[model samples]
Target chain A: MDKKSLTRRLGRPVLGTVAALAMTAGMLGTGPAKAAESFKIGVVTFLSGGAAESFGVPAWNGGKLLIEALNRGGEVPAPYDKKGFGGMTIEYVLVDEAGGATKQVQEFRNLVQREKVDAVLGYVSSGDCLAVPPVADELKAFLILYDCGTPRVFEEASYTYVFRTAAHAAMDNISLARYMKSKGIEAKYFAGINQDYAWGQDSWADFVASMSVIQPGAKVKTALFPKIFAGQYGTEISALMREKPDLVHSSLWGGDLQAFVLQAGARGLFKRAQVAFSAGDHVIPQLGNKMPDGIILGARGVNGLAAKARPNALTTWFWDAYTKEYKVFPVQAPFRMVQGLLGLKTAVEKAMVANGGKKPNAEELAAAMKGLEWDAPSGRIQMTLGGGHQAIQPNAIGRTKWDTAKGEMTLIDVEYYAAECVNPPDGTKAVDWIKAGFPGAKCK
Target chain B: MTLLRSVPAASALAFAALVLAGFVLPDWAMFLVTMAFAKGLVALGIVGLMRGGLVSFGQGLYFCIGAYVSGLMANWTGITDIFLLSLLGVLAAGAIGTIFGPLLANYRGIFFAMLSLSLSMILYGALSKMTTLGGTDGLNVAAPTFLGYAPEGRPLGLALYLYTSAIVVLVGGLMRGLFNSQRGLIALAIRDNELRIEYLGASVRTAMAINYVIAAVLGGLGGVISGLAIGHVDPEFSFWTTSGEFVFVAILSGYLSIPAVFVGSILLEVVRSFSNLYFPNTWQLALGIFLLLVIVLLPRGLGSLTLRRRKAKEQA
Candidate 1:
């Protein structure tokens, strides 16, 4: 071909590609009006690799189920009519945090700004949650923090848009201390093995405070906080064993939790002292049947419990629905997914009523999230004002009961503890609180 | 026409324009733009090494060191001012780089790459172990201060960004000057045939050692800028994966031009954001595939690929 013809041909293709891209983008930009009317909820969670298969996978399943239920419920009527806002159909966009704070922050931005999501639900790691709180506040998006249990969220509870459905480190630590006291076990020496980060550090602080209150003169024999994403833990385990105390507390979760359990079991660390793991659900069932009996375990939230009294119909319905859908009972962290959905429902309902039965936008939604209370699968949840926003809720602590007949690990003496009793008083800086001596700072 | 000779005036003007736009743009755009400049700085550092045929995969270590130094210093000393912290950060990384450069200057091929990767991992391990620096939680670094003005929020941030970017571009110009000089010729000689350069009575190790220090200083500056841009600095900034990413940016841009590195970094961030927006689940896979094709098909990197093809056709 001649140069003129060849140049013309190339130009045509380049122009055609640009035109095509623009047209395609325009078509996508204005999706059918009906599709645009739907209330889109973006669910961000780690879903690949070993960590996802356990905590994130189950949490996603729970979130999926809740979305299905919300869609099935249709427009609000009767008692819920006051709460119903727009003719909204709920949809979800799932994102992976991938175990990085910066990545998770960027993901949050993409969801809130680019995707124009109405609400966000799902996070299983403390790092992701910590990374998100400031951004969520800045963006003014209604963020339902489903499963990051670090107390830092509450400490930074000034963000009116953020609300957590899961139990915090304070509740878990305080509940365990109270439980131990009730059991007439006053242990003097204490040791801890937790994943190194804000969550682990907060857990240790809360545990020390509560333990000191219940059993005075409790000496911290050892405190080991290993980096969270480190693959192997033989060194950390050996160190914990060497520090040998009368009691050991751990807050490791996900793959880290399983690795710790396996190594501790193999190395006879579990058998050394009475072990109390906060968020022990990650190791149960998958290794529960194999876990040596009488380990004195507890997950952050109550799961796998069979109450002596007849359970509530809603509770029964939730369990049946969850089991039928997932083919397994809900565990600790994922259980927050159901709680998150329930909390969001409560917020939406309250907002709708407050707006005089009108549909709410992002700002109204953000405002409604603050000071909201709801009854969820885990129990009552309350959002308190502090830095950005934080929710204090009930927590369940239970022993790992293996029923040889059923071939499972169950929570036998499951007990619910109020979060307010153990939580550090609001408006107090963490640095000052630590220096002043935690839950017992004022009490003493 | 020489490739480097074609574009200085245009780039200088473009950098000025970006700094001005940073003020009017919203938070998100400001974040993205600053990120582009920071990544651009790192790319420039890699360009220095690439000029000598050495592919250093551990720029992340230097970047992390810069960031951590600023973060640690700020938190420990309550010095939230941007200029002081950044200068201190660069100095800290440069000092450490001098030590590391000598150790790495003698190695070549896969050995050099592996050594850099190991160094980054070692830094990651150390940072994670040091709880006072916030460990895995990382230090929440504050924004830079300029002459008693807080340059973090909106208006002032834009001005500060402009000042910082101007320095970066000026540094790029300086790099260009060096690349066109005697030292650059010898570096190219090393790239062509190190054995011949050594036989010519030049101490290759000493030359490479100086080159290593230069790259380290550049990488450290990039790190400090990135830490300022991102608002937080963590140990992951020093991980092997992060280091590999810098190397990927270097490879993607090729060593054709100083500004190509900036474009490459911007392109990477843009592609990542775009991929996440559309593909969601398999975006990383898509990125991998795209990068593979680009590397295999355009081995000279994105900057050189178009020019190389056009030049060849013109010659024919």
Candidate 2:
């Protein structure tokens, strides 16, 4: 084609397209966003990254199962069988939390501003859990952090619209320490290896501080903090072996946990020391026989085998339903997710009553959830910290035992601690509580 | 000088449009554009370096530095004004970028990219270890005041939006002027033939260094705007993947039209938000396919389309 014809062809079409786009923008500029009839909830979880399999997917699975069941009306157990959240049809908007904190901040805003979800209830990454609350409070969107273990979210700052339904990392390590002392496990000259992030550092600090109180005069040999998701543990394991600690503790999770176990197991680190993991139960099914026997561990709470050991009607229904759905026993992630959902259901229903049976707004939801207590599959959850924004729940610890006939790794000699025994009281920080020798703790 | 003669006037118009947009657009759209504008500034820096034949894989280093400077100042000294924070961010990132520019100018191609990558990774490591700064959890930036007025709700969102748009326009105008100036043409010459430029009595390293510093200033500006809008900053700001996104926008815009940088960034944010909303499980895949389609159709990126049409008109 001639140059003049080509110029006209390209320029005319491009100009037309630009004009069309501008028209669309003008149209969009005028319309105000409205909501749907269903009680929409934005569920954020890791659906596609390193944490997806061990934590995010299982948590997402639990959310889908419980939410769908609630919508089905009769599949759920009593008092909670009212169908969906206060008879409003439950519609979920699932978002992948695989991206980092900044991306999560953007996604959180998108969920609130664009999707118009009434409440958001997922964040496995502690970084995300910490980053999202301020935005949530600013936007006045209700947020329920289901799986992140950072105490800083509620401790460092208070939020009116944000709540976490699971106990923070302090509970996991505190319960671990108390369980060890109660079982009379020797812990002198202890060493720790944990991921270097907030979750890992907090877990290690609590364990050491609690050990100082319970097993007084014990010396800390060394604490190695490798970067999170750093698969290789050769150097850290060698360092631990050299220290020849009487006990070793780690709070690693996800692929990091599995990789650490396999690497450390090969070097017989568990045999050399009374090794313990603060949040290790989720790795049980994946590691199977690879996980060395007699390694002390906690699921971060009374979950999986701990919940099974003290079965209730809710526990039986949840465990069976989860296993029947996923073909594996529910672990810490799914259990934690279920408990959070159950708590939300109770809160939503309660808020509905107060809001004249309409789907309540964020303010009503926050009021309903504050200081709320409800029965969960694991046990009861109470919003008792951060002025009724943070949850404190019972947690358990145990030793790994391989069952030959069952062909699975199981927990034996499991011990569960009451909520008051592990979590810090209101207005007290986790680190301070541990360093203060865990005063006023009720350990029964 | 002729590359984009109309850019100065166009950027001013864009600034006016963006300021008007904040008043009419919904909160979500305003936020999306604000964020995109910030990111586009970072990409603009990458383009500045690209014109001097240097491709940095570590702009996130400056981004994180700027974010932390503004965030820490707010958290520590209680300086909550957006304008003051933006100035500090630009100064801090620019100073640091200046220190590394001459050293980096000594290298080229893959070596330059790798060294830049290492620089960002080091920042990531250092920030991750600093537990006092909230470690990997990072710190929250409170709502920044516009001049002394601390607005809340939609007004705060809109204020941040306007502030970001104004900064982008201001920088975009200055960059356009620089790109068409004598020094800018020297950098472009260095990109095409560094040895020839050196033989022609021009200091190639100096030109490269100048471009590097300019890029750093732009990156810092972006970081400040983002810290204000997102209300959080973490080590992830310096992560390699984050830098990769900035570089992607630079590549997608193709160091051609200055406005195309913002277009590319805004397009990416829009695509990401919509696809993630519709296809949560396969959004990354959807993004990959979209990128592939764009590259196939526009070989020199979206900017080249404008260049081609202009060339055809001149021939006619």
Candidate 3:
């Protein structure tokens, strides 16, 4: 048990381990050396969490499929036919967004500072979207917010390095109210049951504001703000039934939406009053026939069944490829993720063209993406809001019916709203615009 | 007692080495190390409680208070000075501890743990509903400046890392000094038998209260550093899961050494970061397995290794 004998036993292994660590550390710091080689993207989504099953997993799945296809080269349609991001060979570093905002910020810094990723496409949570932008701006890294629906991201502050290539919550709710009014669905009174957090609250506020304008005389009977992911809706449904309004509006999605449909449908609340959901079409495939007929829904844009009727070349290829891979029709989550990735790819390639067919830096990428208009499976998306940072895309609303042959709930009487028809103009906030009676709205 | 005289010199050298490493380490590595040190301070507080045979599950109470105070100061006053923010955090958390410490000293064992647990959860619930305070999404903190000297990017990260290391060194030395003092021995005696200490006229309540106050101060300081380093603060700072992490590090390092706490914390961050990088899908499974192995093989924790080596030397 002498010191010399203990040292003899442990010294070699300890020294060897230390040497290995040092070598690895050196390898990790091989940052800019690899920048000229391939275009590295940090694709962050929820690999694990409650959101993983329905939202995050599908988003990452679609992202992986798209990135791999892009790497394979010429699979995607025109203008995007070139190899991985103008033939630089697109590489990805996937990080889970399951952890909270602080963890996300740290991981973001790691991606840019350590991993040397040229750009990052991430986040399905609104909190994370708002949290990451300042860090992105500080680190001078280009970040594309794939699916976070918070308007506050671009509304609160302008950032040189941040962009959300998918439409925020305003369009979803605004489109819902406009669709209801255009169809003349209901006359007098309405109630709402939405989640209480930022997403739900913001959605409810937007819907109410839209209702106040579009359906001017409709009185609000009641509004219930259930907590996010509060799966049970018994009491909320009971309260809604008790109010006995002509219509019920909700922005509930994912599990909360599913649970509300089941609980309220069992109580025959839908029969008592017409129900409309913002961002609800993703649940149709999961709900099948159980999703009540005559219920109105939006896929945040021309997504899911709304896009089924319009199969352009790019749309047809993306739709078939995604269905072939995942074995289910693509929903809003996957569609939004693909849209963000596609937009990022287009921007990178555009920047490369300007840079004489070389990799573009963050500033170059940002410049290329500013006010960029591009095609998506959801139709054309334009950077028209938040001073060319936030996206404004076409969105649709439809009435659902249980189709016998399809053995699923499918949208009927679908109506598409152009990007300008739903989203607010640049320098105008969504709520303020809605409250001001949709001034300067282009409805054609 | 004479053997303890070299602690200040040894610790100064150790701290000097750590600060020097900040100059050479990459920004991300510096950030990771900064986090380990900040979180390690909370573990050190838990270790302080461990010495007194009390485990405070509500250390998050102080942690959150420290963070919110510091964050609010930055947001409200535009004073982004790290020293002033940390001073506010320490003072606010210290005052809260002073008020609650004696009340908490009245309980023991599970009762003590649960009481602390409830206090933090209350803060969590309360913060989640405050819209002006940013609610569940929380508020962002700007990168703090060092005494009016604003550093950006690499230099900023390095400055924060070095500053945090210096604080840890000073506070850790204070803790080490307390452990060697007669008051520390009295706290340990209170742990062994409160009834005996009371019978010996040592005022067990006062000793326990003092120990609690020390933990609150440590927790607050740790919280301020963490909140500023991460550049964001939220109710999650007070969540039970966050407190549980501090406890986990405390158990991993044991109460034997202050330096061992940072090692354990760094080990955890490294394991977590690498595991997540390598195994994105099942990183939780990897982390759970790693923790299980640590608990099984090192019952007294990694700190026990040092204790065993010292004992072996004595025997030889």
Candidate 4:
């Protein structure tokens, strides 16, 4: 071949490569633009990094599964379709909030303004939930708050477009307290180790209040609020050991919890006291045999009573599929995803009905979300509008047990606590809830 | 002289275009541009350190501090005003930087970077454990407030983008001006040969301390804007990866110009956003791949790429 022909051939390949690269870039850049007509739903959660990955990843998976199921199964059949809207294909834009509020807002704004997503879903952290409500209200975008358990998201400001299906900190905390009382574990000198945030603070407050109410003189000895994802827990463990409390309660989920438990167990922290965790089922099973024996662990919405000889098909299917795919049992995180999808499914159907079979935009979806109720794997739950923009939802508790045959963490003797039992009564909320249990009632 | 003067105008025009695109273009495009500017602030701060031959791995500490401080004030105090909250954040970070200044002055190379990283990690630990301060969960940052008007609930896409662009422009100009000063020359000299600068009766440590303070303030300022822009601040801000990202932005921009840093920041945000949009699970991995490509293909950084191309043209 002549030098000129060789040069021309090289030039052709180079041109091809450049064109290919540019085309790739253009395609990657215009993802949301291409999917504009689809019912765009944005999922904001922690999908990368550490702690959030454990729960947030599962939550995302569960959400994806739900979406897949909705798409696969023609419609939600019966009650779900009674509202008049059924069978609509949806597209989702998943964005990592990176487990931070500011990033969440940035991602949320991008979803609303840039992608022009019709609705938003999936937040694993309470802080993100609280951070996003105002933005959602501003955009008039319907947000299905999932995973974030902070009650403050709805309580402080009313966003017509925002609704949370996940059990709030208060709900989980109050339930744990009731479970503790039921167990007759009245030993005092309480100690707490929680992540520093609304959920952590609120959970600690509710626990203390509920414990004080149920068992008097149950003084909290030490309160250790560690930064989320603390690589080491020896120092905090040492302090907890020194305090020498009879019962130890933690809401430590994600990577931090795994690190803490490993370090604490190695240091023999579990041997000294009974342990109660808010998201116990989620974390312990992942621990496998590493989870210490005899630690009284509690998980959110682990109704042991519901798992008789036979359980609901949805619950059974979720458990079987999750284990088969992820090689781990479904936990609180996965359950939260189920709830989030259920919330979306419910709202979309309702909005379709309200709009007289027309597709609902952000405003219609937001309106449909108010006072939303649906049956989840955890059973039926409702998002009731509380004072300000807070959400009132039910909660449950369960003791952790190792299923040796299955090689998994299972909630054995679980009890479902009603929302009213765990919730703060009108005038007396966190303050009164902390006092010794209804001094007037005689074990009724 | 014409090129120098036109730089600001060029930037202003670019920013105006971005803002206009927020209305005319798709929402996703506007979002990518906004993120690009926001991340640019962090990159510029890193450039300040790089200019003095310092590679900071602890920028996240100041970033987290500024963001969390603003977030806390907004949440606990119910002060929805962005400027006031950001001011409080800057003061908090500046106070800490002053203390950190003398301690870090003598350190150089990896030691300086490692020390900074440790400091940020410690802050992360402290924030995570401090329940009253919102711990690992972080604090909610309110929307922008101009005088008495709240911009968060309004037609948010435009005003927010404008605010971000304004900050980026103001900060970029200030950094550029600083880089052109005598101190900037000294900084360059120190990077070239610190021992010679020290022999010339200059207190290398003192100069470094001043530089560090300035960089810290800029970083804190960036954090506040980030907090306002994002509406949430958490302990993760102080993570080593956060600081690494700022470094990445600086290096990617070629540590050359303020606008280049912003461009790099935007590149990163857009790439990450797109990666997540399509790949879903592997956005971080995608970012890693992109960073590797940038490192191999443009060794002098993206800014240097343009400079080198210009020089090649002149030579030809």
Overall lDDT per candidate, in order of appearance: 0.70, 0.87, 0.85, 0.70
What's the best-to-worst order under DockQ? 2, 3, 4, 1
Backbone clash total, candidate 1: 11
Q: Could you tell which candidate, 1 or 3, scores higher by DockQ? A: 3
What local lDDT score does residue B131 receive in model 4, on the 0 to 100 scale?
67
Query: Which ranges in model 3 have alpha carbons more than 4 Å from their true place?
Result: A1-37, B1-5
**Candidate 4 lDDT by residue in tens digits, A50-134:** 7455777777777776676666664334344322225666677888767356556667776776677777886776667767787
Instruction: DockQ winner between 1 and 4, please give it.
Output: 4
lDDT of 2 by residue, B230-297 (tens): 88999999999999999999988887788788888888887787668779999999889878756655
Which tens-of-lDDT digit does each residue in B1-316 have in candidate 3?
2454577986788798997787778888888888888889888988988888989898988888888887889889998999998999889988988998999988988999999899898998888878788877778777799999999878888889999999989988888889889888888887788889889888888888888888898889888888888777888899898899899999988888788899888777777776676688988898898777666556567676667667777799
lDDT of 4 by residue, B1-316 (tens): 2564565776677667656655664554555566567657766777888899998899888888778777777777777676776678778888888999889989999899999899999987777767666556666666767667664443454666777777777777777778888888789899999999999988889888887887787778778877776666777788787888888888877776666787667777766766666676687788788787666555557676456546677799
* TM-score, ranked from best to worst: 2, 3, 1, 4
**Top lDDT: which candidate number?**
2
Worst 10-residue lDDT window, candidate 4 chain B: B151-160
The TM-scores of all predictions, comma-separated, are 0.86, 0.95, 0.94, 0.84
Question: Which clashing pairs does model 3 show?
Answer: none
Pairs of residues at least 3 apart in sequence or in different chains that clash in candidate 2: none
Tens digit of per-residue lDDT, candidate 2, span A203-315: 88888888888889788999999988899999999999999999888998889999999998889888899989888889888888899999898987899888888998888
